[model samples]
Target: MSQTPLQEIELYAFASNSAQFHLTPHEFDVDLGGTVYVSTPIERNELALGAEAAKSALELKLPQTCDLVRHLLANALTGDTTAITLRIARRDPWGDTWWIAGTRWMGRVLGVEVADDGARVRCESAQVSLKRIGLRRLYSRTCSHVLYSAACGASPISASAIVSGSTGRSVDLDGGVPGSVSGGLAGGWLQTPEGARHMIVSETGSGVELLYPATIEPGTEVLLTAGCDHSTATCASRFGNLDNYGGFPAIPSKNPFSTGVF
Candidate 1:
């Protein structure tokens, strides 16, 4: 009896926030037990290894029209790398039979770029996080904790009525019904249900202007987050979470270290 030739195939899988995609450039569709890796125009370059002090990097290239490109752009632009996960696995096929060869690489996405009819994804190994410098205590007045972060513990997000209309960068929220408060969303964010986030540049009459051009449609439910100047007063009056304020409101205007007792 003749033995069937065995072939090895590499598979790529990307997942984030419940959306998962299995892809490969080797075959039309790869089936590993139950999960199928749909073939696509995906390819990756050789992993680059750097010195012990330098971080290793992996770059993946995909067509610009691929759906993965848009997903990558959204995640990268939103700075939500923690939600993105990638894994590369190997499998061997001998005729109709196949077996798993285990995972070859896995890590969080670092960044993405699109150009020349293609998109590139840059990823770093998990160990690279260990190279991060530890945060030192700050005595300055500004808050050290990031807003909405666990350390900050402030939830300013509020769902408003469906959008009434959009003109230029200004979007009419709550059908132009001015909430009881004015300038509630200034210097904050306007987020669409589809996860598109835009910065609120200025609060206009019954609407807020965005920093970017508006594509949001009428009747689209949106979320508005009140902004914070990271001051104790705003923390108390706005979010009503003064207990979690991270800024020092009593810092002396003049630096005592720079100005000695006269």
Candidate 2:
């Protein structure tokens, strides 16, 4: 296969918190024909949010910082690299939870390394504290994209079973193999041998269900892709919010029960 354009650049970051916040990015300049090197100046940011605020407020500041660094790297790098590494250097004296004085969060970029042909791209690590609540959610989104890029050749897994509406039944993949059983997105679920994995669609009740051949152990890395057809339909329907006027009951009176509380 032809090499991707972004197969050489590396990105890393370092962060510090001290009544102030700091973030720095180190770029790796590489000669595709040669080795990569860098000596970029570290970037920094300092801001203050009242100590009494909710942790969520503090958490919100992270994405903008991360985006800034991403944009910087995107502009700095010539093409997409095989892999980029980011390290968030954080120190919370009062713990990852308590945002007291001297509480600090630091971020820094280490650099990037190229992968060999046919080798998977390296996954970036975001070190977060156990006390940090929203970090996991952010990490999931970030890591998912990396995994998708690195595992491009993997096939989708066919679910072992399916549960839709009120009915549950066995499902068979037509000529599908074991590794082909990739997970489905939003409305799609994977069928395991143990039970069915269900994806929630909306508040009302619309989603996909997957029944697997066996119980999926915790921490098992299951690859799931959005079901193209189902996802398209769901999106086209605007998340199941399409108007079904025909199903609406006709009003018996212009003002039912003479009260406007219908």
lDDT string, candidate 1, 16-35, tens digits = 87367778776568777788
lDDT tens readout by residue for model 2, 111-169: 32212211111222233233546633222211122211222222333333232223232
| Candidate 2 whole-model C-alpha lDDT, 0 to 1 | 0.29
RMSD after Cα superposition, model 2: 19.2
Candidate 1, residue 182: Cα displacement in angstroms equals 4.7
Q: Pick the candidate with the highest lDDT.
A: 1
- Model 2 — which ten-residue stretch has the worst lDDT? 53-62
TM-score of 1: 0.54
TM-scores for all candidates: the values are: 0.54, 0.18
Distance from true location, Cα of 38 in model 2, Å: 6.3
